[model samples]
Target: MMNFTNQISTATDPAKIVDELAQGKAEDYNIGFLFVSGLSNTAMAEVIALLRKRLKVDHLLGCTCAGIIGSEAEIERLPASTLILGKLPGVKILPFSLNQTQFDDFQQVDDWLQFFNVFPNENPKFLILPDPFLFDMHEFLSGLNQVYPGCPVIGGLASGAMQPRENLLFINNESFEEGIVGVALVGNFSVSTIVSQGCRPIGQSYIVTRAENNIIYTLAGRPFIQVLEEVLQKATARDRLLAQEAIFLGIAMDEYTHNFKRGDFLIRTVIALDQSTGAGVITDYAKAGQTVQFHVRDAETATEDLNELLLSHRKKEQNKKPLGALVFSCNGRGENLFREKNHDISIIQKCVGPVPAAGFFCAGEIGPVGGSNFLHGFTNSIALFYPEEETAA
Candidate 1:
């Protein structure tokens, strides 16, 4: 059996917050996660020590963030902390941490396997927390994808720090400011991921005919700028207005899948465009023969995107309901983008039925899209835990 519980406290004092979190039926939680907001490094350390001593969790992984998301509320820019405790009867939890220097030393799949002390055949799922300033997110994610193919990596970049070493990452009883901390769950569990990029596809899809690295020179043999202008001219008045600052590019993740639609493309931000040359630069690499489309984002689109994905997950997992969830929402979201509080979490509970969930506003959210993991922004990366049934001998 798998059991999970989540608790949140907004008290200013660390001891009181810990006390509030500890007020519940006692169970030996084998793994735990903590997300803290508006707490100093010293105070967060105290909370970690207290939780470890009180809960006796065997493996704990967490980080500090600009906001904390609990089961019932989303607390932003306040002194808040949320903890998730889980008891799994048949699971192996392995915790590990790596610094920039150690990560740079890793060159092969064997290095990653040795570092985690697990084999690729084990098929473990990872929850990682890395300081946004010091960690090379692209390199780390790419390595994990190569090493553990099809394994889900879910978590977020630590937030609420103005510079390097300001954000805190916790593993077991210790905390650090300049490395990545994570845990590998190896057995008797399943994780379902929902990555909502919060953008609506606009304009027709076009094949990339000319591109170099992250720059798109042509689409369907026409200059990229000309295609974008034609799309805008054909778009609705509201969509054209939104394209001014909210435009993005979505690349089809699977080239073989035909009739692509929403949820079929991996969205990337359009950073700049060369008006004279009709070229555009996006955040991710683009190559010739990839399918591409323009996208737009707004409060309505974000809400719709998240709701649709959650509903789809609910429909797919009708037989085995999730026991718990960890939500890594982009810091750019929340009330700032939604114009209302508790937008994402509320929608989730409404659709998924209030399973124990805890996480934080992240600098960047991490999850898999189309079988490959990538770091994303203005996105909500969620991991839902489900218990696997026993197989016959």
Candidate 2:
């Protein structure tokens, strides 16, 4: 059996928060809590110590964040703390870390994966936390997809620090400045994960006629500049001027269907554009013949995307949904980007029914877009877990 419980604490004291959570926890299985959203690192450490003592579980980890999430209701942006704890009745928890350079070496990485490699158990889902401070998660996530294809990897870039360098990565009890950390949840449970990318298609898809590795030279066999100019003319009046800021490219991949849908775009950051030349530079590997489109985002699109994804899931309720959801959303999202307060969490609660959910705003979000999961931005990954015996899939 698999079970997860989440708790949020407003207490300035970390020890008090742990005591409160420990009281609600069940002791039947090995438990792990991803602690985030505390103001003080010293106090955060104090909370972990208290939890380890009160819970007496060998595994306890997580990091500090700007804020936290739990039960679908959380302090969207405030001094707060949230804990996501899971009881994997028959699963084993394996903790590990990775630096950017270490990411280049999979053997060193897999050596760490050894503890979490509970095979014959089959299809163990990994709960991942990459150090946004030191690792290029875009590359790191691609590597993970290559190595662990089809095995689900969930969670996000841990949040809280203002500077890139100050972001924290924790493993069990230790913290690292520039490394990825996570525990492998390996056992009889089959993992079901969903990536709710809150964006809608504003325009039609285009064809990439010319391109280099990461830059688009042309679309529809025309100059890339001309293609963008043509695409911009069709954007809504409010978004026409903010083209550079709001405009992004959705490149179609061989992995997904060619027919474009509202959420089918593999959204890439529009890193640069040549006003004179009409070229768009992105973060992905581009090539001739790849499908492309000019997409834009605003408050309404974001809100609608969340609602659409959640509503679709809710419509399919004959089967059980996630026992808990780990929401890995972009730091660019949340109140700073949304027009109102608690926007993302509120929609999730509305659709997902307050199942335990916890995560922090990440520097870059990671989820499947199109048919592949890549490191994402301004996106949310909601991974669902149901007990093996309880699930039909």
Candidate 3:
């Protein structure tokens, strides 16, 4: 049997929030933890006092983020908090945190693996939460891959405007700005991830007829700069405005093409556009013949993207659909980023039915891409949990 429970609270006191969640927890939970954060700095002692006082568990782990999300509201927006208690038998759980100085000393992740020397559990799926201030996210991902090739990594940068100088990050009990805190689940328990990019491209797909390192110089045998101008020239004044606001590039995953369904595109952010040469720089390293398209994100695109993810999930041939979903979306994507409040939270519940779900708006997101997962930004990744019998196909 698989089950989870979630709670959302507006009480500023950690203890108050914990009491509410303890009531919601299901009886079957074996191992679980609570992830908490808000605009205020609630010390570990205070957070622990609350957890120990209210909930029972073999072990617990968590960190602070820029904000918290449970239900439809943000904790920072009010005195809000979110919690999820899980039930998983025969599972391995390992938790760790790292600092900037540690990252500097270690050229490769090989250096850090020594810190987690035990390899406590085999075939572990890692859930990472870096102190946004201390860790170079790119290096952190690379290091994990080096040590545990093919391991699934999830979670996001600790949220907040908390920058290097401001210093606001929380892990377990300690607080700092420069390190990351994470929990790695190994053995017995299985993890299945769900990603809701919340976007649908409208532009026609085109081939990257030419390109240089990280920069695109041509498309469909046309000058990269020229094609871009043509797209803008053809756009309506409104589309032109939205394009300037949040334009992205979609690189259709070749893997998706094989599905014989809709085209699959792994979206990438377009970091820059050179008016002088009509070229663009993208987060994805482009290659020849790869399908590329101009994609725009707005309230509509996000709505469509989410519906697609949920629909696809329901359509899966699995014996069971998702019992619960962990929704980690971009901080820029919630009510603050959309035209409406609670849009994502509502869509999810409507489609999946309210199974216990918990997560916060993140600085960046983490999930899969073309069979390999990467930490993503401005995207929504949902890890849907189903019965082990479903995965046994």
Native-referenced Cα lDDT, model 2: 0.69
Error of 3 at 193 (Å): 1.7
Candidate 3 C-alpha error for residue 156, in Å: 2.2
Best by TM-score: 1
lDDT (Cα, tens digit) per residue for candidate 1, span 1-393? 797899999997889988998888377888889889999988988988887778867888898899999998999988899999998778998899989899999988888989999887888898899899877889999999998988889999999797999998989867788889999888877888999999998889999999999999999999999999999999999999999976899999988887876678899999999988799999999999999899999989999999999898888777456898999999999999998999999998998966899999999999998888999999999998888833110
Best lDDT among the predictions, by candidate number: 1
**Superior by lDDT: candidate 1 or candidate 3:** 1
Off by over 4 Å in 1: 389-393
Each candidate structure's TM-score, on Cα atoms with residue i matched to residue i, is 0.97, 0.89, 0.84
Q: Is candidate 1 or candidate 3 better by TM-score?
A: 1
Worst 10 residues of 2 by lDDT: 112-121
Q: Give model 3 RMSD, 1 decimal.
A: 3.6
- lDDT against the true structure, each candidate: 0.89, 0.69, 0.65
Candidate 1 achieves a global lDDT of: 0.89
Q: List where candidate 3 sits over 4 angstroms from the true fold.
A: 24-33, 37-39, 42-45, 71-76, 104-122, 145-150, 165-176, 209-213, 233-241, 255-263, 284-290, 317-321
Model 1: residue 233 alpha-carbon error in angstroms? 0.6
